[model samples]
Each structure stands twice: as structure tokens, then as C-alpha cells.
Target: MKQLIVIGAGQGGLSAAIYAKLKGWDVLVLEGREQSGGKAGGIVQGDYLLDPGPSIIILPRLYEAVFAAAGRKMSDYLVFDKLPTISRIYFEGSPPLDLPGTREECLRTLKEIAPQDYRGIQDLLRKLGSVAPLVDKTVFSRPYLTSKDMLDPGLLQFGLRFNPLRNYRQMVDRWVTSPLLRAFFYGFPSYGGQTWNSKAPGAFLIPYYMIEDGVYFPRGGVRAIPAAFEKLAKELGVEFRYNSKVNEVLGNESKATGVRLTTGEVISAHAVVSNADKLSLLTPRDGDPGWEPSFSYFTCHWGISKTIQGLDHHVLVIPKNFETGFEELYDKRTFPTNPIVYLNAVGALDPLAQPPGKTLLFSVVTAPAEVKGIHWEESKWNYVKSVKSELRSAGIEWCEDDEEFQRIQTPSTFAQRDGNYRGSLYGPDEPHRLMGLFPLGNRDAKWDNLTFCGGSVQPGAGLPMVTLSGKFAVDLLSTR
Candidate 1:
């Protein structure tokens, strides 16, 4: 048996491990964290359950592929319910937009938002219908090793349905007339820690999944999906070692040979795959500084005493002064002290997410990676106070909003726990010019017997992209 040692236990890592085991490799998963699932992990605060990461499970078929590859069907392994309405958005008095999970319902709801914009939305939806196949044929089928994979003339037909050349921001600006509606539609790109303007045109598929494709919640929580995978992988002979952190990637003759753990065990394997933050892993070996941090977040995981009136499963409250609010966040990177809020009340939608009479909200807005070190130290607490005031000022929060159980996640917590590159999420904004070549395959990447996967790599970010990245890695190894 060829021993395989996977260096991380994130969604991509776990998926790779399970698939590798099925392919008949001797698999040993070494996770640095106390548990698996990486950013998709959940937190249990008293009786309230919160997943600060992964708002809703999109691309059900991709997740299904993960389960099936692990030798277990989703139904047999766990119960996941389809959310009737994928998510509901609050545009304030403009009327709430419920992103229903069916095609007809979505079209209907979108028409309600804007009758004139209906034509554009329908055209965009038709464009999205072609995205999955385009991805499979162009980027997903092969690793992004050469410039040709992304820019090949042959692949241009795949992008013809939608103009990948035009900036997405331009598209949104042209397609939607209402500022509130435009912001709501563009929120999809930013969902995965990316900006609509910076992300390629292909990301329009995000909303396609949200409304037409559907969203889901695991019967237990997001953790249930991985826990089931862990069980099934063990059933098929994959060993797991929690708290076994890899200090370095051992190499011989310029090729990876094994890994060195913090406990001093050098576990050699025929193949090595990393699902950890690729950017972080790159820093250890190269002795270089990353470009700059991506956007950081200040999230409040509040367990409200009772559900507030007029709120839905998902909410995006546009501030009375939207431009000023965004300028503070986009230009200053401060806590959007009074910025528009993106909120999700999971318990309101899924009872499994929280105890009775409680609501779990994942509220976050843009902030700089580091808080200027000193200035924010003085203003940190005050900034949070201001943020709270802003939320209530927007009329989304009421008198009892803060009285319930509450917890907050800051940059410091994520920095130490997740070892993310630069404490930012989603990664270094896809590097304007590096979009073509930079952040290429990790120097440690091996093709003969080893492979790579994850958001930082090609085919890009998001659960589906990363899942597809892992699947691509498995295909490479199996072919060899």
C-alpha cells in the first residue's frame, strides 16, 4: 500500500483523504486543529449552535459527490433539508426579497423587485445555465498549470454566453437600476471574501445556485456533513490523527518525501496533499512576505432571546446613507462603524441551528486586516459600541437585541486558530495582474505521485470551486 499523508483536514483536505482511501491508498489524515472541517467548522455556545463560516450549503451535487466518493450516499449517511427559500434579503422599506430556491419562484420574485430589470435577470439566468459545463470543460478538467488553461482560444466559446471580459461591477451597474437591488445582487461575489469588481464574470453562477440551484442545511449542522465523512472514511480504512500539526514538509532530491509533525514524528508517504491555507503554507518554505491582507471581519454571534419582528432567514440592510457607509468600509477598512449590515438568522430557518426561543445571527462587515495596531487598540471597544449603535439605528435591531447570549470573533482568534494567510479571508483579492500566473502551483506541488487543491488554486474560490479543486486533485493522482 502506498502511504498517503494529508496535511490538513479542511473540507478540501477531508474530501481528498476520503477519495484517496477509496482509490486504495494508505491514508493518514493529520489535522492541526482539535477538529476537522477548517473554516466550515461550527461553534456550540451553550444551547445555541453557530457556524461563523459557510452561511448556506450551495452546490448540493458537489457535496453529494464528496459523500458518494467516500462510499456513502448522503441519505444513508445524514439528513439534509432543502431550504424552501434559499435566503431572504432585506432592502428595507423597498420590500424584502426572498430568494426562492426554485427557478420559477426566483424569476417571479425578481420580477417583483424590478419589472423592467426582468429581461436582464432572465438573460443572466440563461447564461448561468451554461456555467457548470463550461467549468467542467475548461478549468475543472485540468490543473491551471499553463496560461493556456485560462486564456485558450478554444475556451472562449465557453465564456461566450456571458461576457467574462466585462467587469462584473459594470454589468451590475448596467443591469440593475436600483442601488438597493444592485447591491443585493452583487452580494454573491463578496460572499466568498471576494469583491464583485475583482472577481471574474464566471461568479454570476453564485446567485444561480442561490435561487435556481437551491441551498441546504445539514440535519445537525454544517459539521454533520464532515462528521459523516469521517465515519465513512474510517469504515473504508483511513487513519486520523487530531492535533498532529505539521511543522514542515520533508523533501529529498527536490521532491516531497514526508512531513515532520510537532511531536517529532516524520511520517513519510507516497503522496502529500495540502488543504490548509496554501498561502500560509507558502510562507513557511519561501521566506517571503505575502502581497497584503485581504478583507478582515468583525462578526457578532448573538443568541437573541426571541426572534425580532420583521426579520427573515437572511438580511442585508442598506443604510440610509449607503455611499458613506461603504466608503468608510472600502476606503478606511474600519469596522464600518455605521455601515450597512449583512445578517443571517439560521435558527429562524432551521430549528437544528439553535435552542427554542433563540436566534443565531452571523453579522459581519468589512474591516482592514490589521487594525493599524495602535489606533484601533484605543478605538476597538468603542468601535464595537458604535457598530451596535449602527445596527439598531438601521432599525433592524430592537430593544432586546443585545440582551441574549452573545459572542464575537475577531482577527486575533482567526489568525491563531486557522493560520489563514494574512488573517484575511478568501485570499489576496486574486491579484489584479497575478490573475494570469501568480499564486501558481505551490513549489512543493508534485505531479508524479502528489497533487494540490483548494480556493487559492485555479478554478478559484468558494465551496464548489474548492470541492472541484479537490476532485481535480484526486483525478490527477488516480490517473498516475
Candidate 2:
């Protein structure tokens, strides 16, 4: 049997291991941390479980495909409940908008919120639906390893549809006129660390997917998705090693033979798959231009003593002065004075995940990636205070008095924990993004036997994309 080694036990790594094992490879996964799931991992405070990263679940079929590949039912390992109201959008001084799962409900809600933009929203969805299949075929199915791959006629035509000349904000303005709708659409680019001025019209597909396919919450917590993958991978005969940090990828410039652990243990394999941050593992060639740091997140997980009423499973609070916040974050490269807040109250949906009469709230704000000027150690707590103030202003009366326990994660945390370049969750910044849609390729450019799979690779960030990235890496290896 062919010997395969996978570094990191993230969603991508676990998926890669499972696929490789089914292909009859003797697979071993080496994780730097003591457990699996990477950023999708959970934090436990007393009896409450808090998810520090990736709360929203979309495109669950990507996960289901993994189980189907193994001839096992996904439901047997993981249970997912589709959220009826995907998120409640709370705009300052305006009535809160409930974004429902199905198209009819969404349309109805839009009609109530912005009567004039209802038609615009419908047209936008139609346009997105038309291009959805092409996006899947061109972007998701493969990796762009060279200039030729990007210059394909089909891909070029796809790019032209979005009019790369205009930025995301311009594209959104053409689709809707209401501030509420604009607020809802404007932030999708930030999901991949792109800004409004970024030439990333492809970001519009995020809301398109949410409205079309529906958003889901896995039973137990967001961590349950990776837990499911880890369980299935183990059952399929893949092996795992925790706290096994890789020091180097050993081989020549053209190929990777295996990895050397930090303890100086040399483990040789026929092929090596890296699910760690590719930037951390690969050395940049001479004259290779450095990538700009992309946007990252500041997260606060709180286990509160009591639940806040009128809170949904997912809630988005858009400040009235959000444009200034965007300018501050993207152009000025500072923490926004009026940041948009995303609050995920898992207990609102899953009662079992929380202790009795307690709430599990995870709040996130988009922030600049770790840059030289801004020191998180000095400013993180101050930022947290501001975020709590914003939460209270939005009617969530969470205070230090009500807090049972709190856990905070900043870009610095991701930098240390995941070794992400400049602590960017979505790899390189927007201006330097690959074809304006992807991260790096799944196959390493210099090493034939080495591959990459994770947030920093093709198909891009978010749990669904990383899950697909694993399959893309395996497919590249199989083809070689």
C-alpha cells in the first residue's frame, strides 16, 4: 500500500486522510494541537461549550459528500438542523429583519423591510442563480496552478460577467438601493477578507447560497461538524498523532519525501499532504512578491447567566455609521470605531448545548490582520470593551455581572495557534487574491508529491470550502 502522511488534523486534514485511506493508502495525521478541528475546535467553560470560530454552517452537502464517499450515512454521525430564520439583521433605528431560509419567506421579509428593493433582490438572486453553476464548475472543481489555468476562455467569460473593473460595493449598488439591503449585502466580501472596494463580485454568491441552499446548525455545536469528520476518519482506519508538530518538509526542491517532526523524528512517506498554513511550511522563492495581510476576526465567547430575549440563532448588528467603519478597517487599517457585530447564540437553537437558564454567545467583528502598528496585546481588551458596549446598545444587556465565563480570540491568537501568515484567516489580502476568487493552489508549485488543503488554499475559506479543499488536494495527488 502507498504510505501517506497528513500534517494537521483540521477539517481539511481529516477529510484528506479519509479520502486517502479509502484509496488504500496507509494514512497518518500529525496534529500540532492535542485535538482535532483546528479553528473549528471548541472551548469548554464549566458545563457550557463555546465555538471560537466558524459558527455559521452553509453548504452542508460538501460535508455529506465525505460520508457518502465512505458508503456511510452522514446522519448516523452528525445531525444538522436547518435554521428557519438564518439570521436576524438588526440595523440601527430600523425594525429588525429576519432573513428566513426559503426563498418565499426571504422575499416576503424583504418586501416588508424595503418594498422598492424587493424586486431588486429578486433580480439579484436570479442573476446569481444563473452564474452559480458556472462558479461551481470553474472555481470550486479545480485549482489554478498557472497563468494558463486562469486564462481559460470559460473562466475569462465568468470573470467578465462580474465586470472586474467595478468593485464589490459598485456591484452591490447596482443590485439594491436600500441601506438595510446594502448593509446585508456589503459584508459578504469580508467573509473572505475582502473589502467593499475589492474586485470580488464573486462574494455576492455567499448570500445567494444562504438564501438558496439554506444555512444549517449542526447538533451539539459548530464543533460537531469536525468532530463528525474526525470520528468517520478514525472509523475508516486513518491514524492520528496529537502534539506532533512538524519542523520541516524533508526532500529536494522538486519533491517532498516526508516531514520531520519538531522532536527530530523523521517519518518517511510516499506522499505528504499539508493541512497546516501553506505559507508557514513553504519558503517563498527569491524575488517572489510578499502578500499583503488579509482581514481577520476578533471573537468573544461568553457563557452568560441568563438568556437575552429576541435573540436568534444567528444575529447581525449593522451600525448606522458602518461605511466609516469599513473605511477605517480597509483603507486606514485600524479597528473600526463602529464595527458590525455578528452574535451567535447557540443556545437559542440548541438548548442542550447550554446549561439551564444560561446563554452561549459568540460575538465576532471583522478587524485588520496583525500589522506592525497595531498591537493586539495592548488594544484587545479595550476593543472587547467597545464590542460589549455595542452589544448592549443593540439590546443585548450582557455585562460582567451576568457573565459566567468569557473567552476571547484575536488575530494574534490565530497567528500563534494556526501559524497563519500575518494571522489572516483567508490567506492573502484581496488585491493579491488568486483570480479574485481563490487562495493558493492545492498542489504545491515546487514540490510534486506535496499538496496543501485548508483555508489558505483553493476554493477559499469557511468550513465548506476547507472541506472541499481536502478532496481537491487528494484529487491532485491521485492525478499525479
lDDT of 2 by residue, 33-133 (tens): 99999999876678987777998898888898899999999999998888898798888887777898887888888898789887878887887888888
- In model 2, where is the ten-residue run with the lowest total lDDT? 281-290
TM-score of each: 0.88, 0.96
lDDT of 1 at 193: 51
Candidate 2 Cα misplacement greater than 4 A, ranges: 283-290, 435-437
lDDT of 1 by residue, 157-227 (tens): 66565565566677777777767667666555454455555535655767777777677777777777667
* 226 Cα displacement, candidate 1 (Å): 1.8
Report per-prediction Cα RMSD to one decimal.
3.1, 1.8
Report the CA-based lDDT of candidate 1 relative to the real structure. Answer: 0.67
Lowest summed-lDDT stretch of 10 residues in model 1? 436-445
lDDT of 1 at 466: 70
Best by lDDT: 2
